[model samples]
Target: MANFTLKVTRLGFCLLQSLSPRIAGKVAFRLFCVTPSSKPKGEKAKRAHAAGVAKLADAERFRLRLSGGGLAHAYRLNGGALGRRGRYLVTHGWGSSSAYMADLATTLAATGAEVIAVDFPGHGCAAGRALHMGMAVKAIAAAEARFGAFDAAIGHSFGGAALIVAAAGLLPGVPAVLPQKLVLIGSPSEMHWLFKGFGKLIGLGWPAQQVFENEVRRVTGRRVEEFDASRTAGAIQRPVLIVHAEDDKEVSADHARRYAAAGDEVRLHWANGFGHRRIVAAQPVLDTITSFLGEVISDKDAEIIPLFDLPARRMSL
Candidate 1:
């Protein structure tokens, strides 16, 4: 009877999820837990595997040394050409470096868009001890000084949240650098829920979730509720493309829906079975981004830089 009752409860929860995805997402985020791997021996191998997977393109790489900030960062720029009107600045997620977005950058470049991919502080070759949204925004500003204003900004996971914070001017004196179009991939709308889910993944109990929230509040000096993308969506007047995978076990797809619900300018694209990381590399995802940027270029305000014109490697197929 106990097992049967559990099964019935699960079925009911599933039915509720079908009926109300947002509420169901909150529930699932609270309940679902992940356990860390016990095999310490595989850590090095895992890092090596991750590095291998990150190797995507052979684009020209350059370093940007920020003046006065005492910081130096690496960036990968592809499809350099004269009279290019627009740029695509890509920010990678937590635990990922600029190399992770190589394929997407390559695809965007191939579609006649100059792509600027940067490594956030404390990641990749960037010289920093810790990563913060302020530093990331500074990096963007520095990049803008060198590469000029971007036509569109695409961020993945944590980078997506940082993108919002950057555009909202949450960091004082940091001017809101608004892009004509914003693309958020696998970004959660609520930081509290996301941190709670992260706690569960690391075996943190309910108490830990509360502590995590408190810490976040103390650090940011703002209530977690204030960061809801749904509430702040109206502040962003530019068109937004929110992409998420239906099978994503990291960040729920409902977060995308919340972003879409926040404003009519937002469009939601739901992909299936690509999981979180693979969704970024998917061809369909690339095609959609290319099409969006192409439209922006057609507006006559933006310039397009074709990859074939670059003096780099020649395309042989």
Candidate 2:
């Protein structure tokens, strides 16, 4: 680990260790779901502003009422014909909102198909304080109902895991949330690993880990131990794009490797310098995503676009 990360981890453990396990769990959970109120300063703010402009350009902002409770905010960036290329869905990861995904959605909208970006429950305009795996699934289902069927879906980080979960039908009443073309940017491949990491960070130990696993099992009705991205990816018979930044400290590129195989069914792209969050804003990364989406919208009936056909993206050192 980097010295800074190690120091932060140590400090976090020291502070959480002073609390009871229950209180520690609560603190950890709160930390996990809370969204930041401020926009990044300097260059980050500039990039974010550019992204927001993309969202506002010929965009129709709307809201959907989720079955679980509150309203889910969305922006539909106008594309070509109403459903010519099929509706495209773009979603941000945990603790993020549709605004963060606006640039990609805007770029994809250039293909002449409406690109809809959503704010999941507990994030953005959606109501909630804590987000469970089940809630993400519900958010997707609600989006599908409100925005129409998605021919292509792009999810960042936790949003990617939620797509797979929705696809697996791990939860009841949700159909296989399949999109003809799917992209996962900086997404983790295993749920158990995330749970264990959270528990370890909060000094919850094995006891807390077990409680988390039990909660996941209770919600999804599946073995938490078997929660692997490869397993879920195997179940979906569609084109998938997986992008992982080599320097990402939050989620390693190895997670992307696990989801990638030796076929056109799944393609993996490596990015650098962008870290976990900025990868979504990098020019090369943006080109890579647009190249993939362009192909999907290029065709009629929304057939699978071969990954090999995409133009090369020059990675920086």
lDDT by residue for model 1 (1-317), tens: 26676566567555765566445444544333221222222676456435533564455566665533635354545445444545788888766666667677767766666778877766666655555444666676667777777778888887787777766766555566677788888887867676654554444445444554555344445566666765565577778888889799888888888898988888888877888888778899988877666645323334543434422322221
lDDT of 1: 0.65
- Per-residue lDDT over 128-219 for candidate 2, one digit per residue giving the tens place of the 0 to 100 score: 66676677777788778876778778889998888877766777666667776788899988887877776665556554445545666665
Clash list (residue pairs), candidate 1: 85-303
| Segments in model 2 whose C-alpha atoms lie over 4 Å from true places | 1-54, 79-83, 262-264, 296-317
**Prediction 2 global C-alpha lDDT:** 0.71
Query: What do the candidate models score in CA lDDT, each in turn?
Result: 0.65, 0.71
Q: What would the TM-scores of all predictions be? A: 0.69, 0.78
Candidate 2 is scored at a TM of 0.78
Error of 1 at 251 (Å): 0.4
